[model samples]
Target: MKTGKKVVILLEAVLAVLVLAAVVLMLQGKNGQDMVKVSVIIQNSDDTQWAAFKYGLKMAAEDQGIEVYIANTGETLTVEEEKSLIEWEISNGADAVIVRPVPEEGAEEMLKKFEKRIPVMLVGSTASKDRSLSALPVTESDNYAMGTALAEELLKDYNNSVEGKTIGIVSETGELESVMNREKGFRDRLLNTGIQILWSVTNRSGEPKENLPADQPEVNFVAALDNNSLTAAGEEAAANNLHGAIVYGIGHSTEAVYYLDTGNVKCLVVPDEFNIGYQSLTEISESLRRFFHKVQDKAVSHTVLRRETLFTKENQEIIFTMSQ
Candidate 1:
């Protein structure tokens, strides 16, 4: 009788431990579920670049276990509006928030404030001061590199013909960092070639009389260098003396592509936005997983993504069919 009672007690203890273990596993599953929620905020979700990035994020999230949400401020958003959108995401329990900033100065401070509570990742560009606010950054391309590459491609085909030719850069605005960088690179490259940059004008702001003096050499090419500024510049170019100048539209904006096909613009430097998005997620997902598992100190942060593909008439068919 005593032996039988001892055996029964042992069996009960084993069953009790098993029940406790099962309960612990259930709680752990719930905790893991909470970690899966991720939100990405952008200036505009419909923009081609952001769309491509979202595609990558979607694909990556599908392969890995994640609940991904994308929020944007629509087609046109001010800095304050975008900031409010991000704050709302954070307040609603977003484990991670990724953003493509509208105004770096104001946005950075807002993002930094949220970072104390949750991980805030910045995708493109940077604030003037580089404090450690971003959990990760994946950028596509910048203006300076695109401008230099555009000039190089032009130079390659032109051989010796472009050496003395003058180029014009038509922009709509001058405040964006990407725009300024491209302009600087374009000027530096052209002037270095001993060629002339005949005129550079903004859309909202017209050309200065002294800058486009009558004695200056004619602009052989006018590079419509931005998506937002292209239409206005195209109109301005048509009205001005550069009606038939070769036009290079930078960035793969829908209007830019249309202009290229209509013969209003010559070519475009398309940034690989999909790749930037995919790589960003692929890299960050693993890092995030590792951080959660305690295998790493923190998520792998700060990746600069490339965003330039030279598009031309010869490659028109390929570019046209691309979804994102």
Candidate 2:
């Protein structure tokens, strides 16, 4: 009888231990059930311009043991489209979301609605038209400073004799806060240089080349503020369509680097997109691990590359992130 009683006691103890384990897992929540999942949304998610940025995201995701999904999106997205995409991400089991916001009307309301449901991290640029909207954390470069650097390089090339140099400006949608800041920075640097800005245009329809008409007026230089604009200007310059304007601009793609290598572009300012990816995910992962952790804004740095310095050991590291 005592032996039978002992067997019953052992069974009960094992059952109790299993029950406690279940309770602990339940208390741990979804995090205990599976790995943390994150989704990313950006404009033209497959574009070559995002090569380095995506590479950074991959490295960070591996390091943090987090699952990341880069949503396929078109070249442009309306605020409504962004809302839908973000909602899909949350509904499909995303513990966190990172997005390059669509700069448009009604963006603030949309972001607020979803931010309450999950942690929303902003990348590339802010979604608000106000430009001062900062309720969420952002990871990007000092666009204004990048612009200043580009102008400084231009000034250096001309031996500070750029007082009367006529210039044309080109960029992606002029509405983006990043793009606007860069233009502002570049213009501010030349505010006292007596340089003439002949024309400035944007590609609202995703076609950078449209800004460069065959009969475009001649300018001493062309300042492109994004990869698309820089590449378009470089191609046009190579074909003698930019009226022999020397190309100086900010870029982040293999094609842009190629242009600089072949002497089609004068100077290239490359923002630290890899760090932007790594740091954004790193912050997001940390927040997931700790409930009250606040991720601060990070303004990544940039590097100025000339053709002669493109193959240096340090620059090659940047290129590997961008191309490989």
Candidate 3:
């Protein structure tokens, strides 16, 4: 009788241990013991503009049981340089890669070739706006829609009576597809509105080549088309260098937010960069887990912010994500 009782106790303890182990395994998912490796490459990866995006990636990394590595990249990357970096990551045993593509000719083709070896995804701008964009998996907001929205906001401010308003357009560079598309959208919306575009300046990312005249001689407003340009515009406005022209543009960064908070920028259109980072990582992890699963293009949303609405519940959440 004593021997039989001892055997029964041992069996119960063994079953309990097995149950606990199963519970842990279930909670940990496929990465209970092994971690999937993913590498991210971005041009100027260290830029603060990527803060929200990086935050999202970090959250997804914890949830999806993957280890992520973002490569140290330069201010501008060439096609050959990007290709070499991808090759190196693969050789270093990266299970997948998330890349911010260099907007150059032949970049898409290069990425597609890497796709064959491992799962690949894109964040932010694609290589081109052609049919090739559909061929690659990407996460980003609709740049064209954002530009149109900015124009709408500006028009609303003027009550659609911009007939006497003269404006100058400032952009990081007139070359980037994003910048060009935004300019097109903004211009298309202003067609027949009688708003005079006095001048359009490109190559104003960092410190301007020349300071904007603070004297109101020709323009009534200055529109910045990208983050760097918007921030530059805001700085000029704060310092009274933009010639009292109202500042407006699309931006995503702490500095941009600071300017908006201080009432320098008239309005800001920000892409949901957090969602871009989170969704991209989640999709890549899903593909790694399920080989048959195919990731598709995800169009994230954007929000137009003004100083008064900057700290609302919803926008505050967005600000938090970007700041942290």
Candidate 4:
């Protein structure tokens, strides 16, 4: 009888352990379903352009009831660092990932790996060569169109006459596809305008007032391709009193607006950064819900912000609030 009793006790103990294990697993599964997690990784997180984008991400995350993890690499990022962060996110059970990948070798392979694990929403430039990743959903401005538009606007000042006129092009880096495209668009648009490109210099170090071309003839216009170049060109123009030369560039920062107000910059091509952030998160959320089968590919539109329109009541409020 004691032997039979011992057998029964062992069976009961085993049953209890199985029940406990099942309950623990059930709890873990429930917790996993309760909250969707997303990770957003950005290169150059210190840039002011990301402020609106971050705000938009937070707002969308709160609205969607999802947890967000943000990783900002303060400097230019590399492929290895990007892969490490992505692996960490995957291990942490991130449901989706939004990243602005640095253009480098193996970027395409890394993105393919990310797509296999979780839905990826790209921002800024498409880091892939051959445009194979063009089908991926991305939130970015039409940089080429922005450059072309800026050139068109500049030409209006000269009454469409480019004869005997020189234009200087300043940019951050040639390594970036966006910068290259913008410069290319601008140059191509002016190909038949009889205007001369004084020089195109890459100022990655961002030295203030040092972006201007040396030994160049008097430039009728200066085209700064990015925010840093824009500021540098503006400062140089202001300090040198180049009032005859119209300086313009692409940026949406308060400093860019300040340059406009001070007559340092003539026109600014501003992309809706807030929309980019908001749309990226919203799309990621939808992708998570729908298994990433329905996200659409599109580019955010760019706006030409002149001084008159920039200081308008609505724009003024937006600029003030964004600066804060």
Candidate 5:
């Protein structure tokens, strides 16, 4: 009887030890053993702006010891597709999400649903003024200020006189608030300058140079407010031999730098996309460390690059590239 009792006690002790070891392993898996995952969704995957942003994000993720998953919604910018990607990320146990939404009617509602479960950060755009989304954080450029500054600088080249001078404006579809605000700011600043806005084209892709009336007053300047527009205008100017027509615009891409170097483009307003990506991820990591409520409405800076300042060796890094 004594021997049997001793045997039973030994078995119980072994079972307790095994249970304790299993609990420890489980805790480690939940805490230190696994990496925290972050999901990033971009509206347009092919854009140079997002390319820079992704570079910053990946660098930050490496520094922070975290995992980042990215998805591109293509050029259509469909809200449903964005929501589907977010849903998949959430279902797969992503701890947080960074998104550049399409700003459609249902976008807010869809984001709010995700916010209830995990942290969501906005990039290149802001959520609506809805009180419910006020807690969401955003990282983007001040488009209005950038536009106003670009116009002011361009005016200097014309001796601040609109007398017999015509400027062409190239912009996006004007459906986005950022594009609209930029156009508005530029137009408002040029209102008193008497510079006639000969034409405002809504197409941002391909060469719209043909749209510039051949018989109209000489176009003293052409301004493109987005990346695609900038490229189109620069190429058009170079191809058609449009001399003395300064092409100024917004964006920082390899092509933009090329145009600047070749003298096809005069000035470019480049937003700090690298910083935007870096900061957004860093902020999201902090939120994971403490509480999600820690990060809110954050803005990045924009730089204006001119032909004379672009190749000075000091400004080579101003343009954002995938390899950089």
Candidate 6:
């Protein structure tokens, strides 16, 4: 009888211990469940490239259980206005802020304003050092490599150099670095190989500026930098009867690939934009972990991951289908 009583007491003690352990585990999990809040401000979220980027960010956030707030800088926001938005996010207790600045120079002021309070990461464009902004996380595609690839594809059909041969660049008026840099790369290679840039037109709208020289273009090429600029360039190309002029778009926007399929554009070059968006969020999460000391991963330095691929008429079918 005593043995039976002792066995019952032992079982009750074990049950009591199990209940206490469950309660402690529940409390600990509750403590660790703090939601990380992140703010992402793109230059303009309405643009296709920005939309794609936001999609990538949202996917990552959903997987990681992060809270993200997205805002657009508007079509005509000034540097001061951009800064005000950043300040507002910081004031509202954002743990980190990722921004695509309206103007490259404008980033410096915003970075100076918020660096000490929270980490600032930039997407889309390059920034000056004074801004204290992290290097844009996307891989810097070798614009020159892209230019070289285009040249090689162009050479496959024609033996003559592009030097002194007129080409037209329909680019953003200003404030877009990636486009300008890619254009420079194209110009450098073509000029070295004997090509002349007849006239470069700057467009604010997705429309072509009326001021481009009307001389007969020998092999006019369109270099659209962003999604908006790319659309405007396409419209201008179709309107201007540049239908078969060896075009090569830099960003992998759907429109850019569509042009290649329709034979409106001869070539396309794209960076790993999907990877860029995915990596940026992963890095942001890691940064948050470092700052909050919730995880033991060491803080990583600024990383620039640049990847580029050349798409041509021959491989347009395979290439265009990947992004969608």
Best by lDDT: 2
In the range 1-324, model 2's lDDT, one tens digit per residue, is 699999999999999999987665443235454888889999888899899998899999999989899999988889889889988887888888888887676776788777776777888776664457667778988888999999999999978788788998988778878898899999999987889998898876454446663346789999999888898888888898877789999998999999999999999999998988998998888877765676678778899999999889999999889985
Worst 10 residues of 6 by lDDT: 296-305
lDDT of 4 at 93: 77
TM-score of each: 0.67, 0.89, 0.84, 0.81, 0.80, 0.70
In lDDT terms, how accurate is model 3?
0.83
Question: Between candidates 1 and 6, which one is better according to lDDT?
Answer: 1
Q: Write the per-residue lDDT of candidate 1 for residues 1-324, one digit (tens) a residue.
A: 699999999999999999887675443333554656577876557666455567768877888776688885575556678778877876776666666655335655665676565555555444323323433343436557776776766666578467677776766545555566667766766665766776776643232434331223557776656664554444444556454566665654455555555555555666555555655555556545554421111212211112123344534433443354
Tens digits of per-residue lDDT, candidate 4, 77-136, equal 788999898888879878788888676777767776778767888886666643444545
lDDT values for all models: 0.57, 0.85, 0.83, 0.76, 0.75, 0.56
Using TM-score as the measure, the top candidate is 2
| Candidate achieving higher lDDT, 5 or 6 | 5
lDDT of model 1 at position 141: 62
Candidate 3 residue-wise lDDT at 272: 93
Model 4 CA lDDT for position 177: 60
Clashing pairs in 4: none
Ranking 2 against 5 by lDDT, winner: 2
Better of 3 and 4 by lDDT: 3
Residue ranges of candidate 4 with Cα displaced over 4 Å: 1-33, 129-135, 205-218, 241-245, 292-294, 317-321
lDDT for model 2, please: 0.85
